[model samples]
Target: FFGDYPREMREMLSSNLPKFTSEEKRLLQNKADFIGVNHYTAIYAKDCISSPCDIKTYEGNAMVQAVGERDGVAIGRPTAFHGYYDVPEGMELIVRYVNQRYKNTPVYITENG
Candidate 1:
């Protein structure tokens, strides 16, 4: 994940994403002992590439349009934060996803709301 950008990110951002030199790539190999995950909630992601969107959202850089609702239904219980939602299951999903991606790297839930 360090030598080159992930395929999805590359596809979305292309040249906007940075490239690493040989020295940087060597330093990144087997470097991390763990991964810190800060998961709050999961939002529905619409492909902005296929649909109209402002393309100025937090996820716009990923070519994804994120929304808290679908078919006028909220994804989960609302939280104090405007966009953050109360979705406990999301935490497990996120941790599991990270574990799979990092492959044996210890994952810590550094923050949750």
Candidate 2:
């Protein structure tokens, strides 16, 4: 639910993933005719202490962001909020990643934001 935030907060959130920003730049090298922007809530990420980082990461409820309940309940995948984040910024990263990893192509994020 990253709907409301001040400019300062927005700036701060945007800074969390520096690697994604860089990758976006690399993608612009070839460029495209049309540009599309999709928006959504940003996700929170964390490192797994005991298990491998990959295992700790889930695509359902847990998703890419590391979220935990305030009461210490371990939240796993399949929860309602798993992929429900309002992180539209992730679209930016997706476009950027695609541009950097593959040939530059016009991009449009079609799924829900």
lDDT of 2 by residue, 35-96 (tens): 45455444445534343445432322232334543245443222355544444456667778
TM-score of each: 0.81, 0.31
Query: Could you give candidate 1's per-residue lDDT for residues 5-111 as a string of tens digits?
Result: 67788787886777878988778776787888877787988778888766675534657778998889998998888987888899898888888877867888798
lDDT of each: 0.79, 0.48
Candidate closest to the true structure, highest lDDT: 1
Q: Model 2 misses residue 82 by how many Å?
A: 4.6
Alpha-carbon error at 63 in model 2, in Å?
A: 14
Worst 10 residues of 2 by lDDT: 56-65
